[model samples]
Target: MKKITVLIVLASFFSCTSTKIIVDRPIVFNDEREALTLEYLENRYGLVQNTPTIVPKMIVLHWTVIPTFEKSFEAFDNPTLPNWRPEIKDISGLNVSSQFMIDRDGTIYRLLPETTMARHVIGLNHCAIGIENVGGTEKLPLTKAQLKSNIWLVRYLKDKYDIDYLIGHYEYTLFENHPLWLERDDGYRTKKTDPGQYFMQKVRDAVSDLNFKPLPNED
Candidate 1:
């Protein structure tokens, strides 16, 4: 009877610990967005899936340089790429997005499906999931609550997917030679420093037991 009681208690504990994600679909999802996403997969990454979806192998953490959740959501909410980024216009007009967004208070919001492709990271988007936190600027730094939230989200994803790596946005370039890094245009890469190294280290340390591969060595 004691053993059964212990098992019940453990189950209850786990149930309480699981993270709850709120769903907030992007304002636009249509044939245009679908086509642009597919074009990006094929033209940029050389991946031609029958559908606009990916089998995630990595999770990339980022920070919205944009300070507020409303603005960040508004930026990614548009399906078409804004006119400001003319450099990537030739590739596709699809605006960059992520699978999930976490607010300053550590509330997790799902902007897109985990399997659906969102143009967050450059090279590895074909098989990587992106998590964008609300802020990364000096005035609105990321918080401990956000850190804990990211740790929980990473663990949750690792449990459900065959996730092999966890990397910061700045580390995306390190995967240039990796088989998963498939961007066709050599000049298409963008420099990034997001969610910061210190924040990523804290997350990595928390999930060290997951045994994900270390970031590829810098050349």
Candidate 2:
């Protein structure tokens, strides 16, 4: 009887403290953008699924170079790539997006479904979930609230998925030779430095008990 009472109290405590996630799904243009996403998955990632859903095996953290959450949302809200990124226009007009975005205040927003593939990471997009935090520049650094939120979010995702890895955007290159690295064009990679090294270390430390696989050593 005492154990049952303790369990009930613990459940109530968790329910009260659970993080709230706002669903603000982006405009997923189905015409050419969706088609291109499908083709990219198939041709680049060797995924042959009929839909864009993914069996997420990893979580990749990022920092939006943009300063404000509103501006960041505006950029990803569109399905077509804005004209500024003309280099990859031929590949697809589809804009880059993440499954979740965290504001400076630690407000969590869902930009896409958990299983849906988003074009945030380069090679592992087919099997990874992306988390984008606003403001990564020197003038506007990430916040403690954001860090707390990230820890909570990562814990939530780990509980829900069979996630095997957690890495920063900068660490994606380390997986180039791994089976998950499947970009067809070796030269198509973009330089990334997001959610900084220190930030990732903090997050990893907070969730170390989860025992996620360490980033592969660079060969």
Candidate 3:
């Protein structure tokens, strides 16, 4: 029975590799305290805490769209929020960054600590693990090795954290009606297609045994 259970888990893990977020490196935190301000956390992630806040809920996936992992890392390494992301920066001192980045070859780079919110998604950062992939072009598609790494990372995160939902960046807007999408009302929105749909489904299926929360307004 134990061997059967292991086989079942392995099979599920393989089936869901397509949409996993691979963390190729160790996670690092920003020394700048401004990045951890409550105002910033509430603004970037819709996290409201009259007290110390710690809630681990979802995992959000993305693609750098940028060509290389180093460039992606450099963009995230900054302590100051980039002007391009000012709308969000204004809301929270927290600059935009992800906890993890996966390269074209599937090498994962940990940009920030999972516990410290590194502004990645507009309304879900407080409770989501944002995993950024290196590139999103047909010429250099996300690879098999990367997919395997993603599975490993997802399994680890699911076991370690109370992660409930897993979604691609493109699906964020869909969550606008959910409780998590409570960012300031600048009417800010971005249409994104990263880490692809087919990729995501595989990941979802792989971790299906974990019994994720029902998506808002599901049949």
For each candidate in turn, the TM-score is 0.89, 0.87, 0.75
> What are the per-residue Cα lDDT tens digits for candidate 2 across 53-152?
8989999999998999889988887777899988776666668889989999988777777898888988899999999999999999999999988888
RMSD of 2: 7.3
Q: Write the per-residue lDDT of candidate 1 for residues 67-171, one digit (tens) a residue.
A: 888899888888899997787777778898999889899877777878999999888988999999998999989999899789888888888899999999999
* Every model: Cα RMSD to truth: 7.3, 7.3, 7.5
Ranking by lDDT: 1, 2, 3
Cα lDDT for residue 51, candidate 2 = 84
How does model 1 fare in lDDT?
Answer: 0.84
User: Lowest summed lDDT over 10 consecutive residues: which window, candidate 1?
Assistant: 2-11
Instruction: Report lDDT per candidate.
Output: 0.84, 0.82, 0.66
Candidate 3 residue-wise lDDT, 22-120, digit = tens: 343433343464436466665555556653234668888877777887777777766666788655665655556777777767565666566656567
Candidate 3 lDDT trough over 10 residues, lowest sum: 1-10
After TM-score superposition, the amount by which residue 141's alpha carbon in candidate 2 deviates from its true location, in angstroms, is: 0.3
lDDT of 1 at 183: 88
What is the total number of backbone clashes in candidate 2? 1
